[model samples]
Target: MGSELRQAFSVIRKAPELISPAAPTPKEFKKLSDIDDQEGLKFHVPSLFFYKNSPSPALEGKDPVKVIREALSKALVFYYPLAGRLREGDNRKLLVDCNGEGILFTEADANVKLEHFGDEIQVPCPYLDQLLYNVPGSDGTLGCPLLLIQVTRLLCGGFILGLRFIHTICDGFGFMQFLKAVEEMTNGANSPSLTPVWQREILNARDPPRITRIHHEFEPVKNSRDIFLNMNLDDMAHKSFYFGPKEIASLRHQLPFHLQNCSRFELITAWLWRCRTIALEPDPDEIVRLSFTASARGKHYNQLIPPGYYGNAFVYPALCSKADDLCRNPLEYAVELVKKAKAEINEEYVRSVADLMVIRGRPKYTSEGYFIVSDNTRTGFDEVDLGWGKPVFGGIAGALLIISFYLKYQKRDGEIGSMVPICLPLSTMEKFQEEMKKMTEAPM
Candidate 1:
């Protein structure tokens, strides 16, 4: 009986670290070419936020070293593949690879203090205000020299864990999965339940693939027409806001022609398209697109991948409308355009996208006008149940204004979804809020 108990205890034993919590940057970084990845070239990384009370009730009494070490151990287990990237030949590819690593953690230097920006801080990036633009060198690695954990004197305490992962290895979903697994492992799980999908052949570029000419369909940036369509167009300022149950119910009643109310995702997307066109103030001849990703692991693509498999298991589906066409059209027409975009999600389209990337010889390209709408409501945010408690709140630390969409549940006043947190450009956020308020308050 005593031996058995000891064996059980061994499973959750704490891991020891030779390097202290406050180590400076590592000496060498791996290069991007070694990874042979297009995503390696793009260094935008996402941040995941969580709020929690410290393990000890006394906030100032808590040990930053202990907390950081525990977090590092958990990160090591969850991001084991990152260590593999460190071993790769090219330091350039390793630089952008989030998987490549020696763990770097920092606590507040004795002289430095944590500052609270309130709701304003909620919208801004926590470290250096760089947000996703913090670039890793040609190598896919970043130097995370410091980790500032706020020790609230009274009740307030917790951490905003930020990871600057190379976007090429995984997307937000994959990152969330990694975080969840780390939390689980810290609580004594041997291995993460997630079966990371690595079947590269399924999405491999076609051999001698015939590429399509439809790339020119997008709007080109002025002063740099040489850049592909929608690459670095004039910056359109926007703002961020969310829709809750109240606002959505109002929209159901406002629309004429027998409204077919859709899911929160479909409804919000349509509303965005409608409002965006209004903001564009565009020519009648140009086409504007509303785009979103379709999950690639459905019944049709089941043969291509298993359900738990992961990678970029998504394909972009776009809806095109003449700028004026969307503005003059009824709300239902916008809804239908989103529905049509949904239909474009298929195996063939996914394959074609892969083939196109390959045929183009995987050239480095940048674009700003493409809007990608993604819903993370289904992502296992709530699944991060550590022994202490579920996260009081969780979200993305910064909103990428250029071309990104992310949605998550909002918890407020002991209720979820007073409004779902939707991210958008700062310029358009107020209008979005007003629209949501009007829609939610409108009669059902």
Candidate 2:
């Protein structure tokens, strides 16, 4: 077969400069307020991709930049035991820059006209917005330790693979335990069979970080630098909104008659929080806020941790109301206010937000203050096989400015629902796809 497809395209053109000298930053790791589970805070920024077919001929002579610098030095020494390094407080032995990391591959040469399978697995998507931008920083270059691309088929004869991650260092079961430690270092397995647990002073937070008001629901923004010292929104030009799937199943069957309890991810996040309060038409006494992401280890906040714990488990409930009480609610009262904002995940509100990030000194929450729901449909994307298979598409990358909702649920011919994939703000995606085709037509 053409000498085994020129020896697997010479082992993927020498695997990205042998994995860019196994890069690692955050000034060289250790900084979730000096680790030890003060809510274990780093290492889960992955960028995966692996579609096959195009490499044959015993993988030809081999030499794509020395097989991408030997697969980025075996993925930067296999992300040193699944990432860890944050030190400073109680002088926990000094090392704080933040988050262990390394991984970024790219090789785009397709032009569009796509659709294949004869050779199997294909989804090209013309260099998917340049392999999504990988954005996460606070020193650690934000995030992107996995991005293997190789779609060379003129327009669509074969080749497709894409994966990306960085939802604050792991969730979705600590990112599948760092993808089962990169599949035991791609099978050569000398170690990393799995067992990485940090400890972050047992998810700390209340030493001296209290605010007190607790009720009046949500208004706190007095001076967290006054919401980025006020506005700029990139001088206007990032508005997109599309709601299909039959207008997300007619707003989840009429938002359960208005929050009596309609689910479909809380009525498509309560009609995207009433379409960002009717596109900031806001005024019903303003005060709007709505955040999402509550997973401190599920099963009703699983006893806080200690079993292969990874980092930044989860939190950010937020959920306030009033822009005409979330645009005259009805989708089951905005899915019972998104199930009362996921009953605010407990464990003392994730150790009082890591003691309010050590009383607000460890700060870093700017995607424009929140509305970021990512559920990657139970994060598995075809259960990332890796033995040399299972991946036609995966997501999350450099996502900024919020309104990022990714909730996959593949399959399609045999049947499987939810797919979501929204990332709006491209100038309000054609009036959000004309109010999502007037809620997926049909009701005449």
Candidate 3:
């Protein structure tokens, strides 16, 4: 690293010793979800939580790094898998080693203050290299620890916790649960609000797997790449557009009687899907799909899937259409399509998808016709308060490794509307802005 940049973001300490769980966690053969076994799951998630400066006196006489390390050590007792490493099983699938190996914890000091970037804290996050250790290597995402964390104390007295997690370890939802556990330990909470459950076997495919309803198709597995990773990242821009509860209510009221009162998530996703597709302006005959995820947690999936089940329990369901048709369809039509996609994902469908994935390696997906939208609002960032104060910027915006992707982030109060963050090729951003203004500002 250059001296100048290093000065801007300097590492304080690197603790690489195994921080084993406070106690020995379960050591069993934990089979991962077939979906979790996807080749594309090789990508690691990047996350950041921004806790604002507090007027409280917790850190008045104590060291922030020392306090955080102690809390994390306590939390690790229950979350041992994090302290472990990833290993490949006989079936070529990956599972946690559950050894007492500790997670890589690095404490850093950033030269800049938190407020220097102004309103959105997610932007100007350029010191990602100093935040987390490297996870990728030869033999495909192997030989890497399951979790890595970097705690940076800002000059403004705030701290940023940057996380890098293997996708197979858990989806974004389950990761939040782990963070909450650590936060609880930090607060001296006797027990976690949600206990970790590892029943990946529950989502296993049926014997002699069968495909009941073929809604979405996947390409053969090969080397997977981010949809727009090859593009120039320097020119790409990341931004958030917000809509309020009242404005969202208006949107829900505008839909037809059958569709009226649909969820804020459904409406926002449908609207954004149309806008993005329109901005891309692809061929009329080209097939385009709006990919949305459905969580099976707390639902009766043949076997009960508890809310605290810390694993990948989400099903990938999407609405597909010809680019031409999607562009010409009414807004409500797209909303209806998204609703139907959600309806199709019952217990049988989710289980069937799992079975199908196991039978056929991970479904190979072509990026051209795919537009994925995940709801960050449900990831529950608001609940991750570490006793200092609530987080100013914490959500799924940092989850994707791709430079270009879209997700909805929960904004702080007084910030009107739902915050939708988008990262797209700079060339297309202007057109996207025009289309976005037209849709968001158009008469309801």
TM-score for all predictions?
A: 0.71, 0.33, 0.86
Worst 10 residues of 3 by lDDT: 399-408
Candidate 1 similarity to native, TM-score: 0.71
Each candidate's lDDT (Cα)?
Answer: 0.48, 0.47, 0.67
Q: Compared with the true structure, what per-residue lDDT tens digits does model 1 show for residues 13-124?
A: 1222222312233333433221124431345444444445445333244444454456555555434443333333332222323333444333322111112323332323
Clashing pairs for predicted structure model 3, backbone only: 18-102, 19-102, 21-77, 22-77, 205-355, 219-364, 243-417, 243-418, 244-417
Tens digit per residue, CA lDDT, model 3, 181-234: 878877777568777777777777888888786646454223432346476667
Q: Give the per-residue lDDT digits (tens) of candidate 2, residues 1-444.
A: 333432332212212321332454333554442212332233333333434433334334333323433443453454442333233446333233334433444454444322332221212222344333333332342333433333233243334444454434445566566665555544445445666665655665555666332322223542222232334655333322334455566666554344534556666776766765555454575556666766677567667676677655666656666667667765466567678767755766666666555654554444332355655557665455444345454443323345444435344353455444343444554555555555565352
Candidate 2 stretches with Cα past 4 Å from truth are 1-30, 33-207, 211-244, 256-265, 269-291, 294-314, 318-334, 339-352, 356-392, 396-405, 408-444
Q: Lowest summed-lDDT stretch of 10 residues in model 2?
A: 117-126
Give the worst 10-residue stretch by lDDT in candidate 1.
145-154
Model 1's C-alpha root-mean-square deviation from the true structure amounts to 10.2
After superposition on all C-alphas, the RMSD of every candidate to the true structure, in Å, is 10.2, 17.5, 4.2
Candidate 3 TM-score versus the reference: 0.86
* Model 3 RMSD in angstroms: 4.2
Candidate that beats the other on lDDT, 1 or 2, i.e. the better one: 1
